[model samples]
Target: MTGFIVPGSPEWLRLITPSKVPAILGVSRFKSQFTLWHEMAGSVAPAPVSERQQDDYDYGHAAEAAAAEYWKWKHAGWRLSRGEVQLRNPSLPFAHLATIDRRASRGRSRRVVEVKTARDLYEYGDDGSGEVPADYAAQVLTQQLISGWHDDADLVVWPQYGMPRIYKVPFNEAVAAAIVARCAAWVESLRAGTPPNLDDSITCYETVRALHPDIDDVEIEIDEGLAVDYLELDARRKEIEAAARGAKTKVLDAMGRARVAVVGDVKVADRRAGKHSIALYPATKNLSQIQEHAA
Candidate 1:
């Protein structure tokens, strides 16, 4: 919103703004970074969200609010920031900024706390020590640089069920420095007005499609490098598919009519649900039977 990016917003993660640094910068290294850049640079329209994803997005906000209230009531000396913070250092990237979630402070010591919902807290290594996933670490570290707290932060993760987990990540100056340098480079790219390099991710494909759904009615020459790679990859994919089909056929033949065939605790039979989901080949009624029925 405005020239600054609101923390935790899709636009914030996707683009570089005066108030927030780009999370998809060099630190994250997700293939979707380029896809995010396209969104940030306004080269492509915003991605269309499906119904299920839209529902998740809506509920995520509600969950965050509930967690904020719970945290405020649960812990003593746990206080929340009244408003959000926007930080854009002159030494950092141009027209880009950093924003943080609720800054939770206890006495004179303050730390940033990011509320998260996860199916598994173990992934972040909820051992009180901050051994978080790389992406999550990058997110809060960038926030730290923007917020100027220069202290540790907390990742409060609530699983869909079971108890919540809290991981305390100390302020990582080394990580922060690298992130700042990377953000500066990304800002240069933004000023230069070019999309980041393309990758094989569906995000890149979809972004292209979203920007140019229809092709112009002109036959133009194009580079053959990608075309050659595509042809080879496509052929290899089909070959692998065929090999898979042959392997499955062998397994089915070994099973005959038996439901599940196993060898040394390894299974190679139908793995779907339902009583009739044995996944064997189906036989069709004979043409003679059809004629007889008609008569």
Candidate 2:
């Protein structure tokens, strides 16, 4: 039997509803759970992604489809094919928290499974030991917790450039409890009508910018420490700007009339003519302005 996708299914509803325990506690490499909190509470509008990222997301779904087939055909233990999973438990503060890729059993031993795709296996590697990234680990943990299967779950890591590997994760009640606690605190903040604090990461900065694209200058004095810090940052930025102009001048002089200068990954190309002369990719320049909007 083939596993079917339930895109508009009830489970999918829970998946998108947010405040998910895994996402709240999960840490991506950037160490930003603040993004998840704001997104979950519906504070920020959806951010735009590149076509390449969209393709990767599509690839992940495709890999999941293939995984369902692999388990059913290759693993004798695989039983009753399924698609979307609704991990629900009334005992939990949140009714639903996560979804599993494909669930199977080895004869009578049933297990929930997560199908994940990555470009490199090394992304999850740690100290020569094959350790799943903490975010994924926390995700599977939440999936198992909500599934009521406890320690019964497996993670299928399908590398785009390497063979697929499976790892079994046992339930960690302490970790699960910690996740629940953090989630509860976050939910409380949401209910209290307080916005979550975001880090100084560019991701957060971009998100803020997207949320508030308009600018009408209105100044309000910030805290003394923060004001001093900003002034220091501005001073350094000016210094960098001056240095950057001089550096570019030197490079341009060396280039003379060369079309492109190749220094490792850094590319300095002539801009007087040709298709490359016109900028194909335009990026937002960082600007310092009074952002009067705050929740």
Query: Which tens-of-lDDT digit does each residue in 140-259 have in candidate 2?
Result: 777776666775567777777667777778888998788777766776777786765777766677777766778878987779998899899999999999997786677667776765
Model 1 stretches with alpha carbons more than 4 Å out:
1-23, 26-31, 69-75, 82-93, 122-130, 239-295
Model 2 worst lDDT run, 10 consecutive residues = 281-290
Total residue pair clashes for candidate 2: 0
Tell me which residue pairs clash in candidate 1: 17-96, 17-97, 18-95, 18-96, 18-97, 19-97, 19-98, 20-97, 20-98, 21-97
Q: What lDDT does model 1 reach?
A: 0.63
RMSD of 1: 12.1
Query: TM-score of the candidate numbered 2?
Result: 0.67
